[model samples]
Target: MTVVFVLGVLLVFVAIALLAMALRPAEEAEGLNRSLAVIEAIADAPKELRKDLEKPFGERVLEPLQQRALAVGRRISGADAEERIRRSLDLAGNPAGWTVDRVTASKVIGAGIGFSFGLLAGMVLTDALTLRLVIAAVGVVLGFFAPNMYLYQLAYDRTNKLQQELPDAIDLMTISVESGLGFDAAVQQVAHNTQGPLADEFSRMLREMQLGMGRAEALRSLNERVNLDDLKAFVSAMVQADSFGIPIAQVLRVQSSEMRVKRRQRAEEKAQQVPVKITVPLIFFILPTLFIAVLGPAAITIMDNF
Candidate 1:
């Protein structure tokens, strides 16, 4: 027993050490530093390829682990999951540094860690072979899917935020256009003055347009990226307006008004559902507690008298 306990303790410490190492922040190099390195690489392109006599210790150690993780992920994850991950990343406004491959790697790493931890737990804490194997299997499955689940949640939350922020962004653009700014200028104004995913999308659309993409195409891409109904409606209207030579300001005003109405309707819908949402808690928790508190003393008195 003593030997087993000591081994378990050692295993736990090793796991903790590994976790700390993984969580430690990497050294951040500045943009200029990166540019200078790139310049040097370009300047050295003509030189013969010479192998580094001594690679950085961390790189030497980590590269093999990263490769293994990627391989493991490739084996476990399907192409469909990868495609879905890409869409989720887009929906999440492409949260900083999070990409499909990164999430896949994380899922692989998590599975490995979970499997190791489960094995150690089973050895230290259980005697039943079936239970131990089951625990380990469950751990592997959970770890493998956890990253995808988190990414889905991020996409869902960001979609909600985009919906919430859209009406205001439309209102801003409407105001800008009514004040005599051209449609493109109004879009630029919204991008510059507003802050949110919608504004960021506007800025990206403008950049796309500036890069020679048609305004209609850029607006379509914007709608595709967000996958929101209101934005899609606005995009469709704008594209139609441009195609038919309708006044841009009129389109803007109509979109702005409709978005406000939709926002209010959403609010009212949620408000109406509140009581329904509260019903389960009220019955299961509050009513039961109230009944116990009110009837407990009376029941005790009746029992005593009997």
Candidate 2:
């Protein structure tokens, strides 16, 4: 009976030792896991951070405000307005960071500013409520259309520049083609050498061609974007030449000569109009100054003598 009791106590001690051994690794593993989690959190602190906290006021506040303004403008504007704006943008060479949304938002902002200024001016200038409201309404109209007017002016100026540069660009292409480069290579040469909207357009057209668009289609696309009659003619000629398998060098030479003649004619026409353009200033300004100088002394002498 004493031996059995001793054996039973030893068995109990063994079981407790086994249980301790089993729990030791698990506790250590749990602590290691917690440490690893802490290390990972420390390592990923920057990546897990909110990026908006570091952004500028323009991006965080102004951008959202602009977006809301854009929504309002879009709701007020119809499809035709958007299309016209898009067309104008394309013609303006799509100025950097200027989008349809931005322009629309700008319209709203401009109108608000104009309205405020007009109200202030009216308060300072007039006491009548009707006249003040009229002035404010006029200001609103002007402000609302200001962006459109600016865009139209930009598009017109760009178109004029493109027109003026086209002849030179074509001449360069002609030279390149005459020097044994293929049509595409000649276009690339022009794009690389020239520095203007013409070169920019050529580069875009070349990209379109490279990206699996047919040459004729690319030319048509360029024509549609440019909104110039001369460019349209050039595009039509190129498309025809491509369709008929005509040698591009000959076409380019002919086009270059035509462009030069047209440019000379334009210069001469402007030269002829110089006299007409100067007439108003000559009569109203120069002649008036001369008359005033010449008559002033004589009139003063007569008045003094009489």
Candidate 3:
């Protein structure tokens, strides 16, 4: 009995050490902690953590692991995790604008939820301790990566939306310029007249140009922010037109036409892909069901005869 007790104690210590090793990756842990701390420091943090986070934003806002506390604060205050992340990033200097904030928030939330759900699923599906642990580990990994997947999707959607709008915007600008407005004035007019994600971006570009950024530099920054191939091509065309002193209206008209062609090609390509995409479902689902319906009665009849 004494030997068993000693062995049990050793096992407990070993378990604790393993947990520490698994959980204590210093940099990542610190980053999570800092994020929690910053969240708690926000004015709307719950009463309990607010007192703790009352210290200066820079210090307490980046303190140690406070996940439980932050979670509690969130529950009490009803703050959305994504919104909290956006506010935190804004306060921290808004690098990459709201896009970075969205990606970071998604990653943090995805990892936490994924790991928790995965572990819960493992517990429900298996009795083996090793399998459970493996599943939990995989859950954590998948959760951490899930946010990146979402971010990529968001970027792709945003780029596509911008591309879809680009030709229309360019055509509008072309008409405005040809109708007697200066190029800069036409850009500003388009920025004001349209209302969408693309217009928001154009407004920012107009602001930058008005603030004394060179036209080329402003267009480059716009391209970087939008990060769409079509927008980049449009920017390149505009730069060439400006450098060579060509008419802005002609440049806009040509780019607009090219963008329309590209859009048409993309639509055709997606239409062509539908049959290939449908094949997997037909093979796996419909075909199997049809086979079962046709063969099931025949098999049963044969068995009856035998």
Report the Cα lDDT for residue 227, model 2.
88
In lDDT terms, how accurate is model 2?
0.90
Query: Which structure among the candidates has the greatest TM-score?
Result: 2
lDDT tens digits by residue: candidate 3, 92-124? 323454454345544556667777988898999
Against the reference, the lDDT scores of all candidates come to 0.85, 0.90, 0.76
lDDT of 1 by residue, 1-306 (tens): 999999999999999999987776555445657889987886676444434534677578766777778877878777698888888788878889887778888888888778888877888889999888888888888887887788778778877888998888888888888888899998899889988787888899999999999999998898888878887899999999999999999988889899999999999999999999999999999999999999999999999999
Ordered list by TM-score, greatest first: 2, 1, 3
How should the candidates be ordered by lDDT, best one leading? 2, 1, 3
TM-score of candidate 3 versus the correct structure, residues matched by position: 0.62
The residue-by-residue lDDT of candidate 2 on 1-306, one tens digit each, is 999999999999999999987788877989999999987876677853746456878998998989888989999998797888888899888999888888999999888888998888889889999999988888888888898898889899998999899998998899999999999999999899879898999999999999999999999999988989889988999999999999999999899999999999999999999999999999999999999899999999999999
- Backbone N/Cα/C clashes per model: 0, 0, 1
TM-score of each: 0.75, 0.81, 0.62
In candidate 1, how many clashes are counted?
A: 0
Q: Which stretches of candidate 1 lie over 4 Å from their true place?
A: 1-58, 75-82, 120-127
lDDT of model 1 at position 122: 84
Task: After the best TM-score superposition of candidate 1, give how far the Cα of residue 197 lies from its true spot, in angstroms.
Answer: 1.3
